[model samples]
Target: MYKSNAFCRKILCGVAFAATVFSTPTFAANDYPNKPIRILVGASAGGGTDILARALAEKFSQALKQTVVVENRPGASQTIAADNTARANPDGYTLLAATNTNQAIAPHILKLSYDPLKDINAVGLIAKVPHVLVVGKNSPYKSVQDVVNAMKADPGKLTYGSSGIGSTQHIAGEAFNLATGAKATHVPYKGSSQAHADIISGEVSMMFDTTSSAMSQIRGGTLRPLAVLSPERSPELPDVPTLAESGIKGADMYTWYGLFVTGGTDPKIVELLNKTLNDALATPDIQQRLKSLGGEITPMSAADLAKLNKEEFERFGKLAKEANLQAQ
Candidate 1:
């Protein structure tokens, strides 16, 4: 009888331990973000991603009632920050301020220390900024066709600039040449600013850049906008036509910024984050602030963003192959 009683108590103790272990997740959920959160960036400070992160951090901190900090981890083609975010704990704190290059293209271009898609769980898209085909204000190429004519005439002699060898700007310029039958030699710089400088100084023929980066130059008449690499016209540069209207319907390319946590983050937590992000973007203030920066909010679920990231990465593969881009 004593043995039976002791066994019963043991079983109860086992049950109690199991319940506590299972309830741990609830404890996590209840006390999520107990401390300040870190939103890591894979770029230099004051860059587009950094700016957007600061803005989001301001509003997100209010929403979550916790201090959110922005940390920039530049260089190695953003591998440093990407790896950091991928390796962070899956609790609701650390996040990657992801972009197309880091999340989609980097895996294909060069080897990375961590698996971007598998190691990181997408939170949501932040903003989408289209690249504009900009030339020096005094250039003779008045339109996309004119630029194509010049490129076809000069072939590799007509050089264009890009942010880097494996950048979206590089891919877009290459793809544009492929689709439009323009054969310009690609001249890559360490960053868009360098390329834009050369273009403004007429050292390079042309370049495609994000509206935000090129906005000041465009408005200041230093860089003339020929076409925007989007399916539609940019509200910031409404006068410019989509690269499609210039006869290349698919020349449209964009720079997208997003949020992510380490993969295998609890599904409920991921969903909660997704909903919070979408709700944040839906806010009139956020939308207006983003739009003013020549971008639009692109709210999406974690799964949807992941699917979109994969599809876009794969699609860029086809475009990259078609463009005959040499692997770097």
Candidate 2:
């Protein structure tokens, strides 16, 4: 009778432990964000990604009634920040402000310490910004065809600038070469600002710059807009034609921004973050701010963001393979 009672006690203890273990996540999710939350950005503060991150952080803090912070890690094409986030505890506190460059493009070219799709759980998608093909204000190439004609005529004499090799801008330039059957020498810069300066001064022929990065110069009349590298024209630059409209096909591209937490995060926490993000995005002030920066607000569920990330990863992988792009 003593032995049987002891065995029964052991069984009961095991069940209680299991229940506690299983219920811990629910309890944590319910009391989530009790402490400060941090969003890691892969780019330096003041860049387009950082700007959006700060904006979203403000919204998240207000919605969750917690202190949310944007921390910039800024290297290896945003992978440093991503890897850090992936390795963080699966609580909802540490989040990654991810872009296509890190989530989709970098994995194809750079050796990464984390699996973007697997090591990180998608929280939600925030916005997308299309690349704008631009040239120096005083350039002779007036349009996409003019640039194509120049490239074909010189057979690699024309050169283009980008943030860096294996960057979205570089891939867009290479995609342009493949689609239009033109060749232009690629000149990679340390950052978009240097590339923009060079392009504006005619140091390079052109650049496929993100709309947010190029908008100020474009408005200042130092950089001339040629076409947008997206399926459709951007609302910010509605008068600008798409690459397809310019008779260039198979080269549509854009950079997207989203939120992510470490993999194995509880579904309840993910849902909470997703709802907060979508609600923040739906606000008028936030909408206007993001729009002014040339971003299209793209609120989506965590599952949908995951699906989109996978699709982008595969698509960019194919593009990288075809373009013979490798990190340099």
Candidate 3:
């Protein structure tokens, strides 16, 4: 009788332990974000991602009633920050500032240690910024067709600058070539700063640069906006025409930024975060801040963001194959 009692006690203890372990997440979610949160960006300080991250951190701090920090882990095309976030505990504290380049294109250009789609869960989408095809203020190419005609006139004679060899700017340049049936040489720089410098000096012909990075120059009348590489016109540059409006199809591209947490995060915690983020995005102050920086607010639910992430992953595969981009 004692032996049977001992066995029953052991079974009860095992069940209790399992229940405690399974219920811990629920408990954590109930008191979600009691501590400070950190949002990691995969770029150096002062870059577009970092800038946006700081803005978001401020809003998140205000909304969550806890301190929020923006941490930069720039390297390997944003895989470093992503890997760090992926390895972090699936709690509500650590977050990743994910961009389409890191979440979508990097997987094709670089062999990542983690599966971006599987290792990170989408919390919400923040904004989308289109790349503008800009030339020096004095350039003779007044329109996208002018550049296309010039490229067809002398294939590979026109040179374009980008942030790097495998950057989204490079991808945009190549997509432009494929779409226009024109060949243009690619001149890559370490970052957009140097590329923009050269383009302004007429050392390079053009660059498909983000509206945020090119906003100052555009406003100063230093860069001529020929067309934006998005399906829709950017409100920041409402006067500029889209590639489609310019009669150039199939070169559509835009940079999107979103929020992410480690995969397997508690659903309740995720829901709380999504609510906080969507609320922050809806604030008039946040809206104005993002708009001033050339970002178009594209607030989306977590489920919708996840759906878009999957679609972008597949679309990038096609772009990689079409552009002959190989994994380095």
Top of the candidates by lDDT: 2
lDDT of 3 by residue, 1-328 (tens): 9999999999999999999999999999998888999999876665567877898899889888999999888766677889999999999799999788778887888877899898999999999888899999988899999999999999988999876555677789889988888899988664566677788888899999878667778888888999999888887888999999999898887788899999999989889889988988899988887897678888798899999999998888787876788643
Report lDDT (CA) for all predictions: 0.80, 0.88, 0.85
Q: Give model 2 RMSD, 1 decimal.
A: 2.5
**What is the per-residue lDDT of model 1 for residues 1-328, given as tens digits with 9 covering 90 to 100?**
9999999999999999999988877788777868998888876665567778888888888888889999988655556788988888878788888788777765677667888779988889888898899999888889988988887777788888875666777777777877877688888665566677789888899998777667878888999999999888888788888888888766678898889988767777777777878888888888887886689776788878999888888876676566556655
Off by over 4 Å in 1: 1-25, 138-140, 189-191
Question: C-alpha displacement of 7 in model 2, angstroms?
Answer: 3.4
**How many clashes does the backbone of model 3 have?**
0
By TM-score, the candidates rank as 2, 3, 1
Indicate the TM-score of model 1: 0.84
For model 2, what is the C-alpha lDDT against the true structure? 0.88
For candidate 3, list the clashing residue pairs, or say none.
none
Error of 2 at 255 (Å): 1.8
Question: What order do you get sorting by lDDT, best first?
Answer: 2, 3, 1
- How large is the C-alpha RMSD of every model relative to the true structure? 3.2, 2.5, 2.6
